[model samples]
Target: MQRRGFLKLGVGAAVVIGVAGAGVALIKPGLVDGKLGPGARDVMRAAAQAVLYDLLPPPGAARDAALALQLDRLDAFIASLPAPTRKELSDALGLLATAAGRFALVGLSRPWAEATVYEVHEALNAMRVSTSNTRQQIYHALRDLNVVAFFNSPDNWRSVGYPGPVQIP
Candidate 1:
């Protein structure tokens, strides 16, 4: 083939492959639902519980309610991200939910839901201070998401001494 024709063919092939890959990513179950899958959701919940231990209410109705609210907010946050970002977070959460990933990422061999609060804290600290920028980013992302979701709620504002925004009559 002529050089110009060969270059055009290569570019066309690249575009086809990129479109196909994007289509596959868009069809992933989590993306379709606009939220993490059950296992990933569980992992996120555990991470939030651990990171927000001091801030969250004691285990009971209040805590459950707060967690549910936070999870909803977290889901919405994830959904609002760009497609590539949402996919990256979904992949990360899926990895964290597995025993192997837990061991590798957090130095724990158990599932995230079964990890003790101290263990979770250790894992998060490890990620936060990890030399890998990816690990640190993951730690900060989850921590920030949980804090923002929890504090954004009016019910929790009292705990933070944040009165509702003043209304200008």
Candidate 2:
């Protein structure tokens, strides 16, 4: 586990990725496919970071809003992902959302907040443990989704006086 060896591994992985890209261009769509895109990965990472900030008790409006925007971008990204990968991500999100919704129904802000937070975190944990190529993407999705659930929660909205923004017809 020398530092030099680790660095070499990193370099090797990058080379592999570069070769894969060249191969993809040379090969046909039917031959092989990898749906995740760099832009989407960026969105996911940003979203995850935002959610981390928003989960604090007081909540973070700027971060939450940022995460929401990222989620919108993610929605588009998800569409481009392989169908199986999309389904996996969707299922994980659905679990988190369902837990959040149940907690919201009870008006238990604190627990709802906790459950929502944990669910997304758990999703990220699962993604990391799995062999999915989109582990990073899932991590991003979980992070963003949690922030969205938190900011949109009744408690956060009431605290912030976040009236739906004015319509701009």
Candidate 3:
């Protein structure tokens, strides 16, 4: 083959390999089959409990059921997001799933599921007040998801004194 043609082929091959590697990196284990894996789900549950502790019903079957419903809703909402957004959330959740990531991001060396409510609260507060924009973004995203999932439910309307939609004439 001509030297110029060989160079062009080599460049094309390198580009293809780079693109393939990037695609593989995007498919992390935290998102299994395009949904949150068990670890990620657990992290999200802990986050919801911590961030919405005051707003949630008292500890009992009722609270458990409410959290389950909200988690389901959040899962659905996440599934409906665009691919890039979903991947971003999955990546964030993946980080939260690991002890190393927890310590790095929240300054806690324990898994999120094992962290006390107070500990989780402190971690979340740290994220909220951190100088790093990524930390703030993670805090906001989790907080917003928790609040939106909880308050949007009909069961929670009474807590905020928001009556149901108006009746038609």
Candidate 4:
């Protein structure tokens, strides 16, 4: 594409995403009062499952507990973020929770709650390689947030083969 055409596409993607974010926030409101509600948690859970599939335990009670812990950590981390950052995160999560947004942005036609780990993984991979910078940023935000939340707990370090931080005298 020509430089001007590319620039226009970029601007167009930004505007559409912003408008969708706002509309999703006002309509369904995945986050209640800037907190992760059921919808937000569902979105995060799906993405986390995809991004951390290898790191996560096999399906069972252990896996469920691990996911629960990660979600809890994510909630705490979001609570610590600045208002604007938290709002953006909320909006992003909210967008992912919507059917139209999920299909348009993540390329996932199925609901997050119903999507398999493999399906979610494919969707995320698609976003990561998309021509749209906006989609790449969204992928990073979703993946990185889950990575941070999963690794924030020292208890999870053994899973990733990290022996904990090096001791300094």
**Highest TM-score model number:** 4
Model 4 lDDT per residue over 99-150, tens place: 8788888898888889999999999999999998978999998899899988
Please give, for residues 1-169, the per-residue lDDT of candidate 1 as tens digits.
Answer: 8999999998998677546544543443333366878767777788889888988889899888877878898887777779888777766665565554556556776777778778888889999899978678878877887887777678778877889899999
CA shift of 128, model 3, Å:
0.5
Candidate 3: residue 167 lDDT (0-100): 100
Model 2 worst lDDT run, 10 consecutive residues:
99-108
Query: lDDT of all the models against the reference?
Result: 0.74, 0.47, 0.78, 0.85
The reply for model 2, stretches above 4 Å from the true place, is 1-60, 99-169
> In candidate 3, how many Å is residue 4 off?
43
TM-score, one value per model: 0.74, 0.31, 0.77, 0.86
Task: Estimate candidate 2's alpha-carbon lDDT, on a 0 to 1 scale.
Answer: 0.47
How far in Å is the alpha carbon of 75 misplaced in model 4? Answer: 0.1
**CA shift at 119, candidate 1, in angstroms?**
1.1
Question: How would you order the candidates by TM-score, starting with the best?
Answer: 4, 3, 1, 2
Model 2 pairs whose backbones collide:
none
Q: What is the C-alpha lDDT profile of model 2 across 13-94, one tens digit per residue?
A: 8677546544542332211223323333332443355355444334477656755555554454555668776655544433
Q: List the residue pairs that clash in candidate 3.
A: none
Task: Record all residue pairs in model 4 with backbone atoms less than 3 Å apart, i.e. clashing.
Answer: none
The TM-score of predicted model 2 comes to 0.31
Model 1 misplaced stretches (Cα beyond 4 Å): 1-32, 167-169
